[model samples]
Target: MKASSGYAGVPRWVLAIAIIGALFVVLPLVAMVVRVNWGQLIPLITSKESTDALLLSLRTSGAATLLCIIVGVPMALVLARTRFPGQRIVRSLVLLPLVLPPVVGGIALLYTFGRQGLLKAPMDFLGIQIAFSTTAVILAQTFVALPFLVLSLEGALRTVGTRYEAIGATLGAGPTTVLRRITLPLVLPALVSGAVLSFARALGEFGATLTFAGSLQGVTRTLPLEIYLQRESDPDAAVALALVLVAVAILVVGLAHQASLGNAGGRQRLL
Candidate 1:
């Protein structure tokens, strides 16, 4: 006799609930698509303000993703491959931004980098101004995006384990050499997924950027912020811009999903 499928064990009620959950997530996107003024979509999204916001968002998000990869790789390596005092606490703190409200993050950033902040003296001594600048927007995006990369890469590293690294060391490979040759190649797919996710998160960043950078067209006003500002004055334009943001988000999410699948496939092959 033919065997039952794995999902055959799921109850009808569970399937019904799952459908509801999917609809709950999907219906809003459907509604937004329906609300878009197709005839005016191009004109609306091509406006000077919209273009500026789009370009700024892309630039900042790209920079934030790069920053996430640079710092997050080391952080994941430390968390996954090393043991030290307060390690748990450090990991928790590193992941805090994932759960913390964006506004709260912005507030934290403000006090840490703002004019009258704790670092004010040092900042003034160096003649560096970070608050309410484009740099502040990039920093805010990085602050929130970093956790995604760190979490993804760390999990991947943990799963791949240190066996290969140990073997490399036994063969006279130095720590850096082992990491460069073995560990990173093993988790490259995860790193790509994490970086893409970070870019997506940075693109959607609004509250922290608003609080920290203070919206300035062609400067700090990213797409999400632009959508908010346009909501009152031009609902149609806002909807159009929102759709653009949604499209970019969908592309990024799709890339991340593919990368994750590759990561899983690689792990299976390794095993």
Candidate 2:
């Protein structure tokens, strides 16, 4: 941390760029907030269509976040704690969605889960239909949100390291015991931060969901999808939904920030 009083000799250009970057993120939110029609804000958001969209968004995003926690934790563990041939390639594949366009992801999902997909015969045999349904929304959100969890958990695991687990093992504790008692608790903050990020990402998912889930109201139309639909006919509703999304983003960022601060404080204490 730097002194509160001054820049501590930071270069002007670097500071200017950093300020610009911050403004780029913050300005859009300010613009949306400024344009909100306060008179109809509550009614607009609480309208039947808006409520349905909000509820669907929350449920699907929540489910997606849970899925990320379930899968991402173990995947991060494998990446951080084990090594094998093609490990880098595997990690890169798992994180491909971070860089891949949402439309591309949607297309990939459509091919993989659609009626005539590669595994269609097996899925049909098992009676599992995933594409263009509520399940598809969760899957798409998970695809986009998974990287946040995996990267966050992997960094946490790296920071906590294996020393504690090693000591616990020497003390006759089992692997699961050590993980449950020591490793997980140590990384809980990062896990939480990651979950917040994942949920936020899922909540704001639009492109993949639109491409894969097709924006059926109350079935697959999430907040972002609803906002898009409202944009052309009801601009106020679109702005209202955008503001709601901005609020959710702020909440997620605040929670993640707090978790990061806790993580930093814990590390400082250890130091």
Candidate 3:
């Protein structure tokens, strides 16, 4: 061990900076928790509209996450494991929704799938009116949340090297067999974590859902929308709703963290 020149090899300034940064990050959560009025929490949550919005939020977000899994897992495989001309561009395009403003995303969806949109005639012929409906809520949530699943799964794929898959292929395994048996199991934890996080994000979504789905009661009014509307008429009720969202967010993120850590630990044990 090296001798310290009265500094213990770690400057007090650095420790202070770290503590300050941590406090800054944690203060808002603390504030929200402290501000919540616990006395009326249950009654506030039991309000008809609040319950409706909460259920709608869960249903739509869950549906959107299912859609993400159906579409995103394959795309993640392509982006992480394959190569072609313009491959980098294609990968970047997948992440565009994450960085884009949600309202702008809503407008983009409107232009592409709304009434009188590019495919409007065919969609109308098929009796598919996508805007301002429960279906629209799912679409808006899926549009914003798909990238999260894709990106997380891509990272997991990168971590899980292709060597195992190549060896499986040499062992008389077909592409489908290798993917179903080898690739999916190895990446499942990431996929699950991504799905959970995406569901939480979609549940808390506001701008795009409002713009595309139109806050119709019991149809499209999700928890966030209800909270926004309630703020104008009942501030206490809004705070209670906000607390619920905060609790859900915390639980989701905590589960994601635990799941990711468990996966890493399992992988290490296997190695």
lDDT of each: 0.95, 0.93, 0.90
What is the C-alpha lDDT profile of model 3 across 1-271, one tens digit per residue? 8676435577778878888999998998888778778898899999899999999999999999999999999999999999899998998888999999999888888877899678899998999999899999999999999999999999989997898899999999999999999998988889888998899889888889888889999999999999999999988899899989988988999988887987697678657
What's model 3's TM-score?
0.94
Candidate 2 vs. true structure, TM-score: 0.95
Best of the two (1, 3) by lDDT: 1
Q: Candidate 1 lDDT, tens digit per residue, 1-271?
A: 8665446877677888999999999999999999999999999999999999999999999998999999999999999988999999999999999999999999999999999998999999999999999899999999999999999999999999889889999999998999899999999999999999999999999989999999999989999999999999999999999999999999999999999999999999999
Q: In what order do the candidates fall by lDDT, top score first?
A: 1, 2, 3
Q: What TM-score number comes out for model 1?
A: 0.97
Candidate 1 deviates by what RMSD?
Answer: 1.5
- Can you list the residue pairs that collide in candidate 1? none
Candidate 1 least-lDDT 10 residues: 2-11
Residues 147-191 of candidate 2 have per-residue lDDT tens digits of 999999999899878998899999999989998998898888899
lDDT for model 1 comes to 0.95
Candidate 3 wrong stretches, greater than 4 Å? 3-12
Q: Given candidate 2, what's the lDDT at residue 191?
A: 93
Among all candidates shown, the one with the greatest TM-score: 1
lDDT of 2 at 38: 95
Model 2, position 270, has a per-residue lDDT of: 63
